[model samples]
Target chain A: MAPPSEEPTDGAVSPADYRTLCDLLRERTGLSFTEAKRYYVQRRLAERVEATRMPSVRDYLNLLRFQASGAEMQLLVNLMTVNETYFFREKYQLDCLVNGMLDEVVRHRRPGERVRLWSAGCATGEEPYSIAITLLERWPRVDEFQIELYASDIDSMALDRAREGVYGERSLQALPAELVERYFRPVAPGSWRIIDELRESVDFSLVNIVDPAQVRRFTGIDVVFCRNLLIYFDDLGRRNAAAMFHEALSPGGFVALGHSESMSRMSSLFVPRRFPDAILYQKPAEGAGA
Target chain B: MGLVKAGSKGTLGTAPTGAAAPEDWTALLEHADAGHRRHAAQALGDRPDAAATLAARLPREPDPAVREALLTALVRIGSPEAAAGLAPMLASEDAGLRNGALESLQQMPVDAVEPQMDALAGSDDSDLRIFAVLLAARLGPAERSARLHQALERDPHVNVGLTAAEAVAELGDPAALPALEAFAARFPDDPCVAYTVDAARRRFRGAS
Candidate 1:
């Protein structure tokens, strides 16, 4: 027996159908949409709806659910997502690294020890690449300690782009021309590819931080930069992600969240460390546990 | 030693084989390292059979992160058994555990938590009853207004009455006004009671 299709009244996505679709999107990806994005979502939704040759949005929903390859889902992710990913998105955090965190991180470290930094929700590698550039340009002790950088995003398409390491003018807006000249060479007129060495520095992977199977592997991290990502997570998801970061960090390791997001509000697992320049959260030393 | 691509996978410990047995994860719940224990609790959310074990560990678990994992796992299980496991933790003297249990209970369906609420409200401990009232308030007026109104009218503790009054104000249940007046007359000396009663009166009058 065939399922009857509920064609929307105006031959467009209905409010009920829009909510149902958005709920599915939120379930699969952490991204959410409010009524403000309805037009934008509807526009992209219309294209997919047309492209799939479904009679209506309801039928398209069935395709979205039963599609084994998840091809349509990827298209929706790429289209609906416009989260700003750019070099030096927040300069103060970089300043905190050079002036405060790195100095303190090295002071307690033995000679020639490896320092690991994990960047959760590093969308298309801009933030992690900027960190790499900061270490090379500003931190004089960059050569004294081994630095292992890992950046992860839940989006496979974004991870592919991150590995490619090419960016247009918008992604590099925060970067000074001199630094840009030093780090990247033009593959085209406006787009530039990160110099091979810098591109290879960050090992990018597809990771959803909430899933224990995916997140449990990260351990002994010295600093974690999970900026602007937890805002999408609900209470439980945020708590679990905080736990993952705490478990991953070495004793006394620091976590750098987005300027707007606070670790203290999300979980009591990490200790809040206030520096004159910036406040960061740290995994408490063994004697001190929150 | 400059920037090095240390590969994606960490070299710390061998990865556990595919789909660890529930018993394996349950044992890991007691692992000496809090991280492993935390991971174990999180992984056991997929195993309803381990809900009791997670609830049992909540009181004894020293690490906040691991205790959180236990609460989250129990919330995810969301069975009556899981709710039962969490209800006992509400009686804990440790504020963190009690609060954690409350927050987790709020995530459950009202039906799953209703039995636990009855038990907690009946507890001789004022703190436990307050916690139950807090859970009801968190669940909101639509789910447990009758219980809250009853608590306001009957519960002997001033704090419990205060919580119920606040719940009425916050939830804005006009039907709860008589209970609010009873509470107001019940505790005339406490200014907060009169203040809350006035607030609820204002909210109801405005709504009408």
Candidate 2:
């Protein structure tokens, strides 16, 4: 093996090393990195060189490709994945979820049949908690109807944060003042602790959305908020994720996308349905009303 | 990447001198010489609707000095259109262009920041992505945490990653701890990397 260059262009990852790393990242996670992201990839993997005690990027690539166990690869995934989220993000969509989508699900389900809302890519629990807050606020009689809120993200650390249910003031900005007052108690200055009631409502898990077997585990979901997620996925991953959502949702169940995202280019499994100011895709129902 | 450089000049030395009509300024903006275009850009600064024309010319402007002047004009115009125009400069290889764009973006209204930063944050250019992370850090805590986290995770540039590690030090988001630790581990010999990671670890752990 060639000896590592002591002076590797002052933080520049060698081109060959970068390509090897990109291939591994793409194969493992379906993340597409461009030349623009080359520096970022090099930097993220550089961290691994020290943590894993690998001699160089080349050795680290070798370990990731041929030697390291699942735990080690998982550590790399943890380092490289993006997890940006906050409570009540994109309120217009939340408004549609509570006022329109859930109402439709409520009307169709048999008595005592619960509604399950799955927040895919629910970074740090904000999206799932936002769903719970919406249900509690808009559907005060939330108990009357069975409700199960399942939130999953590939990032384990984010899942832990979701479980803790503590948020800084910045997270609460988009949230209505009254909702903040009612649903959260100030745990520290500028930080609000989500009440147990809201915390307990969400079932947080570490599940990769693109994994068919993993996504298959989520079944009969009434609504899936996979917002801001597919944007990170390449075409194959996005299509697979779409197919998984289609299979996971019961007929007539809805899926919401981030404002900048769209299903028009990816799938035909769900039809776009417009709400007051937002749009959600809905699976077609099988049987007509008697 | 090609870099552009030019001698810096002070802002339009004197008040506009009631220079020609908006239409004349618009035409002069395309004049062959850099000075004529610079003055035209300065003259159009007060006309909000002229933003589109100004924004359109920025990316193609060959002169760094005029580009800087146009950037200043955009800042003075201070419209969403102007802010949108500045986004292309963030991806420029020229340090002056990027800095000028960032300087104007910093002064933009809160609502204008996201649209300007959004394209760059998602840009295929590493330079823009790095600037996006830095810009996000300056926006607010929420934006800082969000953009820096994304930059730390997905950016391929070492400088961008290192910059992100340092920026996240202020937010103290524990989610950054693993990445920071990884960074420290990767560049154990680099004191700057170690210090950044250690400080971030302390802050994030303390926050938790």
Model 1 misplaced regions, further than 4 Å: A1-82, B8-14, B30-36, B151-154, B168-182, B192-208
Using DockQ as the measure, the top candidate is 1
Which digits, one per residue and each the tens of the lDDT, describe model 1 over residues A70-178?
7888777777765577999878888898888988877888868888888899888998999999999998999998898889987778888988999999999989999
Q: Report the number of clashing residue pairs per model.
A: 0, 14
Per-residue error for B152 in candidate 1, Å, reads 4.1
Error of 2 at B92 (Å): 47
Per-model TM-score of chain B: 0.87, 0.71
Instruction: Point out where model 2 deviates above 4 Å.
Output: A1-9, A287-290, B1-208
Candidate 2 lDDT tens digits, A203-283: 777787755446646777888998888887655456557766776787888899999999865554468899895899887
On lDDT, the candidate that comes out on top is: 1
The local distance difference test score of each candidate is 0.82, 0.73
Model 1, span B1-208: residue lDDT tens: 6898757335433345574566788888888987678778888887888888998888889988789888888887888889999998877789888777877888776677877877888889998889888878765446678778888899999899889888878776689888999998889899888887898899989887
Clashing residue pairs found in predicted model 1? none
What's the lDDT for residue A6 in model 2? Answer: 39
